[model samples]
Target chain A: MVAQIVFIIILLGAVYLFGKNVAKVRRNILLGRDTDRSDRPAERWAIMTKVALGQTKMVKRPIAAVMHFFIYVGFVIINLEVLEIMIDGIFGSHRIFSKPLGSLYGLLIGGFEVLALLVLVSCVVFLARRNILKLKRFSGTEMTAWPKSDANYILTIEILLMTAFLTMNAADYKLQLLHFGHYATAGSFPISGFIAPLLPSGPGALAGIERGCWWFHIIGILAFLNYLPYSKHFHILLAFPNVYYSNLKPKGEFTDMASVTNEVKAMLDPSFVPEPAEVSRFGVKDVTDLTWKNLMEAYTCTECGRCTSVCPANITGKLLSPRKIMMDTRDRLVEVGNNIDKHGKDYTDDKTLLDNYITREELWACTTCNACTEACPVNINPLEIITEMRRYVVMEESQAPASLNNMFGNMENNGAPWKYSQADRLNWAASDKVD
Target chain B: MEQKIPTMAEMAAEGNEPEILFWVGCAGSFDERAQKITRNICKILHHVGISYAVLGTEESCTGDPAKRAGNEFLFQMQAMVNIEVLNGYNIKKIVTGCPHCFNTIRNEYPGLGGTYEVIHHTQLIQGLIDEGKLKAEGGESFKGRKITFHDPCYLGRGNNVYEAPRAALEILDTELVEMKRCKSNGLCCGAGGAQMFKEPEKGNKDINDERMLDVIETGASVIASGCPFCMTMLTDGVKHMEKEQEIKVLDIAEITVRANGL
Candidate 1:
């Protein structure tokens, strides 16, 4: 009864904290400008199914895909065992489903055991890939101490949880063999049976080990759930919604600015009266100026660096790493969110996403090649943020590069990006043919 | 030799509309090297007997560079001016020799109310080959020489027109090769997003120099391109590496004209 009370208290505390963090994150994301992404429900659903649920893009790298497949499947399948553990914890019953389920319970637990082993092995390999092999993508400039440690911590936690689960079953299996009280012959432990021989052959020791593991597994999972909202691992939940609202237009299309359109219309027409509205900013200088979709994209970034690895500018040793763009956005957003939490919703920090986190060199180095967008597993568009920041720099601040200023001037006056006159447009046709 | 390319004004005066409007972009009009590509595009249209009219003085910038360079006000102004002229003519079909012009007019112009059937010149040549209007049988033979196609970011990943350009080249007698990063994975030529007009930001190496390594890896003697900007960058890349004698950077239309004897 005392154990059940403690379990209930811990579970509720974890749930409440997790709920608070989720609410904070949602509020942070909604702080951005409004844009409708509710159109074409059927198409969005199809894409969500293919990209997030099916993990189709993950398979682009076959080795990592296969390993990730193991971990993902294991995480899902092992949740069934977690359900059993939850019930057992609440009722203070040992394997309560054993009587009703009988043979089927053994089969299911046996399958979960196999998956737990795979999850354990995969996590170790992932850890080694990060720490041992030191994959270039994982050790990017943006992946400082905290991000790197966060990844290592998650992998280590998973490894420990899987170990506990298997060992718990092994201890339980031994207790059942001795026909101990409440330790009914329920689960068929194919893996734990191998481990059973190694454990101490004593009933009291076995019971303590089983109970200790049960508490550890449940508590670890609850802690992991709470950890997700504050970590890059938040992608596990956000990837679905992020991909559903993907920009389905042709990659070449840059969205026309309505503010610019209204201004241009008034300039072009003598009789036209522009709509009286709030003084609209040209583009995103900070998170608040960005669309909600862009904010959600920042939250959904996995920091996998698939984007940075394929970036043309980053490939040539340029300052523009697409992964870093997403990281900086998220970091700045988190800071803004913290400020809001402490100083109320209308708080201002005077620092923007531009100049503080992302540099001008990084912004200009981008070729606007959509490689980052194509390479993102969750369909996050870093180019959108880069372009929006560029717009703010040029239109709001009037700080465009000298060469680009020349090009704009020529386009304004000569009707082209050069000093040549529009009257000479037909000169190419009249010129002598090259042999 | 003068080619007498008819202007939209002349076509309208004759109470007729050409089959397509040849959008002579700024580079095609002014740049000395890009002018040769513009002439070949006109030659191909004339040889295939497809009636096309140039917008001539009426054509203005499509605002691709300005928009990309973060100057939205200038871009929209340029777009509106071009849209007004294009809508005034009621142009139904348009073709462009430059991928930047092709992409901007096709995708961006429609939102600004300048809708038309826009296609890159490579796609037009591919269609001609498909319909048996053009053949590579009679022109300069590249049978023994190795050729490779550099997918322009605008036309390939930007618009998903990867196959059309390759189809135009596949019709040739030359052996076609591929860079390791081709199609959707093609690297930028350090020329898009108004980067052509400006020097690149400080980096370990220029993007074109890095891309040239990919070209060199393929060991292709002839690099076929579809964008004027890409042509300039690749040609400069060849000079940068001093492989001008070993490698020739030719526009896809230029290659088409050489192969089809147009």
Candidate 2:
């Protein structure tokens, strides 16, 4: 009776904390401007399935894709065991399914053991790639202490959780071997059975070890769930929605702000002049100006640097790294979110998202090539953010580079980006050398 | 081919309807190198007997460069004026030698109420050949000469028309030599997203120079593309490498014109 009460309190506490964190993140994403993506439900569903659930783009890099596939699939399937763990924890029961499940329990446990082992192996390989090999993507200027450690922390957590799970199973199987009270000869531990003999034999010690692993495993999962909102691992949950909301229009299409376009239409009119439309700030000035989908995109970045690695601007050694662009957006988003949390909705601080974090140099370096968008495994569009920020710099501040100003001036005066008049546009056709 | 290239107003004055409006983009209308490609496309269009008319002086910039440079105001101004002209002429179809213009018209104009069936010249040439309106005679057989095709990022990736340009070039009676990065994975010729209108910021190497190295490695005697901006950039890249005589940077329209003995 006491044990069930204790379990209920701990479980309720974890549940409450996890719910609050998720709510905070949802609120943070909703703080951005509204964008209507309600059209084409069928297409969005297909995209979510193919990119996120199917992992179609992930396989572009064959080796890493294979390793990640094992980890991803293992993580998903292993969570089924968590359902039983929760039920067992809440009721203070041991091996609840072993009686009715018969050998099915053995098969299930055996499958989980195999997956757990694969997960552990992939985690070590990933750690080696990041730490010992010091892969270029894993150790750049952008990969600084917190981001780097965040990656390691999640991996280490997975390793610990899996170890505890297997250790618990091993101890339980040993108790079954000893034919202890109420211990059934049920589970077939393929991987953990070998380790069972090494564990301490006393009934009290065995119960202690099993009970300890059980508590640690459940608590570790809850902690990991809450940590997601603050880390790049948020992609694990947000990738589906991110790809679903990806801009499906032809990449060349730039989004026209309705306010700007409405005023622009009136400007094109010859005769009638109404009062000037109340123009708000052009482009993005803060996280608030960015669309909700853009915020979701920032949250969905995996920081894998695939986008950065494939970026032409980055490859050619430009200041633009698509990975850094996303990281900065996420960082600023967190900053703004915290500010709002402290000061309420209408808060005004001296800082803005534009210059406070992402720089003008980084925004200008992008060629808008769409390479970053294409290479993203989860369909995070960093190019969209860069272009949006560039829009901010150009339209809001009118502080474009001199050459761009010259081009814009030419476009305005000559109706083309060259200095020649529109009348002379056909002069190249009259050249005798052309024939 | 002394063809009568009527302007939209001239065609309307004659009380005739053109099959398509040939949008002679700013680059094709002004740039020295791009002009040659424009003439070649015109020759092929005439040979195929497609009833097409040029907007001539009536056409303004498509505002692609301006829009890409983040000047939405300038872009909309240019777009609204051009849309008025096209709609006044009741132009239903637009064919252009520039992918930048093609993309802006097909994608952007609809939001501001200008809509037309737009085609790149490569797609036009491929369509003509496919419809039996034009044919290749193998007279200017490029059998012995190696040729490679560069996918313009705007035409290939931006618009997803990779196969059409390749189909047009495949008429050469010899297979195209593939660059290390070709088709969807193709590199930009360093002139996209208004990068052509201004100089790129400082970097270790220019994208065009890196792209040129890909072209040089293929040992192609001719580099064919669909977009005029790419033609200009690749032509400059060829000169920078001092391989002007060794390799020719020509549009696929030019290739088809020469291949068909037009």
Candidate 3:
């Protein structure tokens, strides 16, 4: 009766927290204005195929890709095992799978244990690659605060979970041995088989150990579930749908400019044209400026730094780093969310928050090359955000690059960038021998 | 019927409801050789009994360069004005020798409420050949001389018409070699996006220079392109690298006109 009450309370608590966390993320995703360009069918297919199934961006780094694939697959397969563990904890029987299916469940648990070991080893390599090896790709790259510590904890939890599985398997193996008074299925649990000879031979003590191992496995899983929202492992839950609905537009396709009159009519009008008194303006200054999808992208960033590695600007000693952009956005969102929770919507001034978080030069430095967008493993389109900021800078404030100002002046007056007479447009063609 | 071969001026004068409007873009109106190619296209159209009208000086820049430079308002203004002018004449279809103009009028103009059925001169000429309205006289066969075709971005990827120019060259019996990155992935010729008018950005080498090197690597003696801007850029690249003798740049229209002995 005590176990049942504990199980129900823990299960309800986890479900509520999980739903709340995911709901907060969904709300954040919806807050941003619609910015997708889904005009072309081919473009949509290309994005879906490349980002969803191909996993092209992740494959750029083979070692990381292999490690991530195993972890991803293992996490998916192990969910059923988790449910079975919970049911077994509550009812004192692994009734989720019967006889032959139980044997298959055992095999699956064994396979997942091996995969979890591989994931732990791979994550160590990833750590060394980030910290000790200090790969140039990761140098000065922005990472989530406590990334190293979080990674270590996540890895430890995963290792502990696998260890619990093995311990429970070994205790079962010992019970089976003692029950039959022999070891016919000794080879079935190869790793656990060795533990039988070492364990005490009495049935009573072995049964006690079995109960203890069951508690360890169940508690370990529950603890891991509760810890997921606060760890980099959150991506494990978020990346699937993020990859599924990845933007599939052509590289240069921009969001349609809002119709001026419609935008005006939506605002309070004092003159012939209505100027929106509360226009959000272009460019993300803070978390609220980011669409809910952008917020989701920030949360889903695995801090892998693949985007920074391939950025041409970063390669050429530029101040812009795409990884930093995601990290910054994520940090700002958390800050704003905390403030809002504590003091409601009017807790902090939006302009002050934006000015402090995003810099003008950082916005201007982007080349709109689509390199960062192409490099992002999670399919985050940073270029679209940067371009929107650029549009705002150019249209609302009339602020642009000095060179562009001169060029725009020439285009307005001479109908070309050359500042020459419009008649001279064909001078280059005149010099060419057409026949 | 001994149909008259119209000069650009004569074509502009006919003023009838032509089945097609020949867009004598800025290049063809002022450039000598482009004008010659325009005249040849007119002659071909006459032989084929296809009535076409020429929009002479009335045609202006399609504002492609302006739009690419982030001058969206000016581009939209120019596009709106051009749409009004074209709509006034009920000009629903257009053929142009310039790929820049072809791409602008067909692709970009529609964003500002202008839409027209636009085709490049090569596409139209290829259509003429397909219908048996035009025939090629057997030339020196272009057999031994290795040749390659440069896919101009505006005509190829920007508009997604890759096969027509190659189809035209193949009919001329030329050995057509393709560069490593051709078609949609074709390298820019250090032109387009208004880069032709502005100073080239700071890079170790020009994109056109890089593209020309790719062409030379194919061991082609002649580089054929459809766009006049690409033609000039490639020609200049060849001359700058002193590969003038090794490679020649010719517009596919000029090449087709030669193959037809016009």
Candidate 4:
């Protein structure tokens, strides 16, 4: 009875902590401006089905895709086992499902064992890709310290959790064979039975080992749930909603600025004097200026570096990595969130997302080709952020590159980007043909 | 050589409304190489007997480069001016040989109150073929030859105009072959997003040079494109590769004129 009380308390405490962290992340994302993405329902459903549930974009890289699919599918399937574990923890019962479900429980256990092994193998491959292969996209300055370490840490934890589950199953199987009290002779441990011989032989030894593995696995899982909000692994929970709320317009369309449209509206109508609305800012200066969708996109990034890998600027040795752009936005937003949390609502940070995190050189390097947005498996639009910053630099600060200045000057003076006047526009028609 | 091209001002003074207004973009107006593409488009229009007048002196840049270069204010100023002139003439149903101008007019101009039925020259030429108005007479120059159409970014990926240019090319007797990256996946000619106005940042290679390799590998002697900016970049690329004499980079309008013996 004491053990049951202790188990319930610990489980509830972990659940409360996990819930708190998730709320903290939710609050941080809500710090940005509002953006209405509720227009299209049928389109969003189709995209969510293809991207998150169907894993359509994942298969672009076949070998890695299959490995990731194994782990992804396996993890989802094994989550059922976790529900059973959590129920057992609450009621102080062992293998409760075995009695009610009968022989079906053995089949489920066998499937879980096979899936756990697959997950372990895939985790090993992921570790190898990150550590051994040192893929160029994964080795850049953006991925230098904590992000890289965080990746390895998550993979290691997953590896440990899978190992513990297998070992615990194996020990329990051995104990059952010895006719121990309350040790049900159920659960076909196909892969873990191999571990039975490796464990020490006596019922007390096996019981101790089994209980240790079980406790460690459950504790590690709870810790992992809490850790997700702080890591890129949060994409596991966020991908579905992120892809579902994607911008459904044609990829070629650039949305007109609401302020620009309003200003244009006033210009077109000569009759009514418009109200002096808050002098609207042209473009984003920081995370507060970006839409909630943009903030959510930054949060959903898996740090897979797929966007950076295919980025023309990064591939051509330019400073702009679309993945890094997303990272900097998230970092700056987190900084602002922390400041506001500590110092009420009036807190201000000395740095902004423009020059403090992402540089002018990085912004200028982008070709705005939509490659990064297209390449994103979860539909993150790093280009939108880049363009918004460029808008700030040009409209708010009136600072643009020299050549662009020349182009803008000509556009203002002569209705064209070139110095030649519109008077000579038709000169080509009257000019002698070279041929 | 003076073709007596009617301006919108002239057509309006005579109380005439043209079926379409030709928006001669900056490149088509001033650039020497692009002038030929402008001429071919005009010839095809005249041959089809479609009443089209140019903005001429009234025609100015579409402010596409300014908008793309992050000068929204300048872009709006220029767009409003052009919209005034176009609206003053009460013109509608415009066509242009440049995809940049087509994209800006079709997609961007409506926000500033300048809306019209904008058609690309390739699409116009494709329509004329379908209408049985402009027929391709084989053996003029490019009969029984392999001709590859380079999809302009603004026309292809930018506005979902992949089929019209290819359909226009189908009117010719030339065999059509595709590069490794063509159509929606077509590589840029290093010119979109105002990149044409500035030098590329230091890299191992130029985008146009890389795209040229795709063109060269296809073994198509005649490189056809639908945008004037693409013509200039790919022409420079062919010159850089020293394949100028062998591989001729012609606009799709130029091909249409050649095939029809216009």
Global lDDT of each candidate: 0.90, 0.84, 0.65, 0.84
Clashes of 2: 0
Q: What is the TM-score (0 to 1) of candidate 1?
A: 0.98
Candidate 2 Cα outliers beyond 4 Å, as residue runs? A197-204, A270-279, B217-219
- Each candidate: chain B TM-score: 0.98, 0.97, 0.89, 0.97
Q: Estimate each model's TM-score.
A: 0.98, 0.95, 0.70, 0.91
lDDT (10s digit) by residue, model 3, range A1-435: 787777778777877887787676566566566656446656556665676555666786687788877766666776776777677556655435545565775676567666655665676776677668877765573543486577667766776666666666677677676564332242146665655677787777776776677677677676777677666677776775676667643344444444532343333234546444456554444567666667778788866666666553454455667777776777677777667677886787554223465555655555444556656777886665555555555665777666667766765676444455665533422334333
DockQ scores of the candidates: 0.76, 0.60, 0.12, 0.51
Model 4, total clashes: 0
- Stretches of candidate 4 off by over 4 Å are A175-179, A193-197, A264-272, B1-6, B10-16, B49-51, B88-92, B125-150, B170-177, B181-185, B216-222
TM-score, ranked from best to worst: 1, 2, 4, 3
lDDT of 1 at A299: 92
**lDDT by residue for model 2 over A1-435, one digit each (tens)?**
787788788778878987887787788889888889988999999999998999999887898998898889999998889988888878877778877888898899999999999999999999999999988877566888999999999899999999999999998888888888767688789999877888999977897898899889988898788788888898989998888887888876778766767778677775645566555577877887888888888888889998888677777887778888788878888888888789987888888778887777777777776767777888777777777777778887898888989988988888878887888876755645446
Per-residue lDDT tens digits for candidate 1, residues B84-107, read 988888899999988899999999
Give me the runs in candidate 1 sitting further than 4 Å from their true place.
none
Ordered by DockQ, highest first, the candidates read 1, 2, 4, 3
Worst 10 residues of 1 chain A by lDDT: A426-435
Task: Assess candidate 2 and give its TM-score to the true structure.
Answer: 0.95
Least accurate stretch of 10 residues (summed lDDT) in model 2 chain A?
A: A270-279
State the lDDT at B113 in candidate 1.
87
